[model samples]
Target: MDTRSLVQYELFGLWLLKRMALRFRCFAKDERCRGSSVIGLVCSWIETDLEGYRFGDNLIVGSMLDDLAPDTEDHQSRYTSSALDAVNAASIMLDFLKTRDVSLIKEIADLARDSVDMLAQEMISDDLTEAALENAIENHPLMVEELSLQEYLWSLAGEVAGSGDFFGDLIRANAEVEARLMK
Candidate 1:
């Protein structure tokens, strides 16, 4: 894809991941009101199930539209299925990230290599630096705010081994999955 499309893809992916992460954190803080929001309910459901064996993205998204919506209005107007799928992917990513193994990123990167560039793929596999970590921290609020600078930096570096394509690959993978679901 061209640079503009690539940038938009990356930006959207980052935003979705951050939003999902924030939602998960919010649910973790209080798991009581599952009916409060569709995203919150989905997060709760996913967290309680097996890591990767639980509900499929399509299933969860369908449920979100059919059952989880807090109201009866046209919910599709407020959310896209693709975006919901990304949220599901981000939740899975959060689960994987809990392991603190950056090598795990390779599996995700490999899955979406076609959508990402070699340079970003290489970065995803490289070591994480304070600069990069700071950038992530700035871009992602509650997601990493709980970690000390060093902890956050090492977490992503050690998890992804410093390569830079981690998030990019994730975004691409999300798009790929959404496309497949569309078909």
Candidate 2:
């Protein structure tokens, strides 16, 4: 697609994502692409879910077009068949990995080689709060103000560790003790 066309799509996607932010305030702070807003949103969803955070307790990756394409033919929208809907939704969820839709992101598994199991942990951490990410999303700034997603995750881990939540506090205390013992 031409640059102009891509920009148009991104703009439309931005509009849709921003509207989604009302429901999923977290989406308001995710990274975006100038060329494709839908892809941008999808990438953000994947990365956040991988970190264990989500908009809610329900399916972290729900219908991509629950609101976007309503009133359209049911086929292009959501399939009533739960299994097909899951398969179709999986395609959208994996679209980022398949197309490299966003640039500069290494696979989370690649970054989490040592602690890949964390991928299965429920999202009790929220270092990149909806407000903080919302700023980055709206301003198009890096969520960490840095490049390496790996470093950002660790830094975020520390923040989560210190967040006063029982789990987060325990993680933070453990890390500090480990640091002290190392020294």
Candidate 3:
């Protein structure tokens, strides 16, 4: 791929990842109303809004990979490596949510820190470094400004962790909407 294409691809990937992370954070805070339909709607919005954006096609790399030459082991390996890194970052975040331990969250933050420690880290170039990522993870600016909003909602609902209900509602709402759209 040419340099322009590579740049486009990276930008698109970053956009998608950032969207996913934001949605995840929102779901974490508002578990009570989360459902597949809600999540689907949010995702649909992302796709639609980003459709004609500069790096939109870069978001299609996973689909394109399978069509690449099967014998191109090096190419496949590099793709796999990058994919794994993304997966690892996401996994660490998920684990932190599941545990809800401040220490664990801090640790996960550290992983992100480590990932972006290098001057050449894409997070740095993309302006999505660990500090920004942690801020996004802990507090989704688009959703609400105060952590108290989440805490209050959870308290009213008499729940701890504030994750299960919110994310469950979002996933279910998203699925419902997707199903209807497909019909």
- Among the numbered candidates, top TM-score falls to 3
Q: Write the per-residue lDDT of candidate 2 for residues 122-170, one digit (tens) a residue.
A: 2224467867644444343222222243343444444543354735553
123-172: candidate 1 lDDT, tens digit per residue: 34246686785454344433233223223323432333223565555445
TM-score of 3: 0.24
* CA displacement after TM-score superposition, residue 143 of candidate 3 (Å): 26
Q: In each prediction, how many residue pairs overlap at the backbone (N, C-alpha, C within less than 3 A)?
A: 14, 3, 24
Residue 97 lDDT in model 3?
A: 29
Candidate 1: segments with Cα more than 4 A from true spot: 1-4, 7-11, 20-31, 35-60, 71-183
Per-model TM-score, in order, reads 0.23, 0.19, 0.24
Which candidate ranks first by lDDT, i.e. highest? 1
Write down the lDDT that model 2 would get: 0.34
Candidates sorted by lDDT, descending order?
A: 1, 3, 2
Q: Candidate 3: which stretches are off by over 4 Å?
A: 1-83, 118-183
Where does candidate 3 have its weakest 10-residue lDDT segment?
Answer: 153-162
Alpha-carbon RMSD, each predicted model: 16.7, 18.7, 17.9
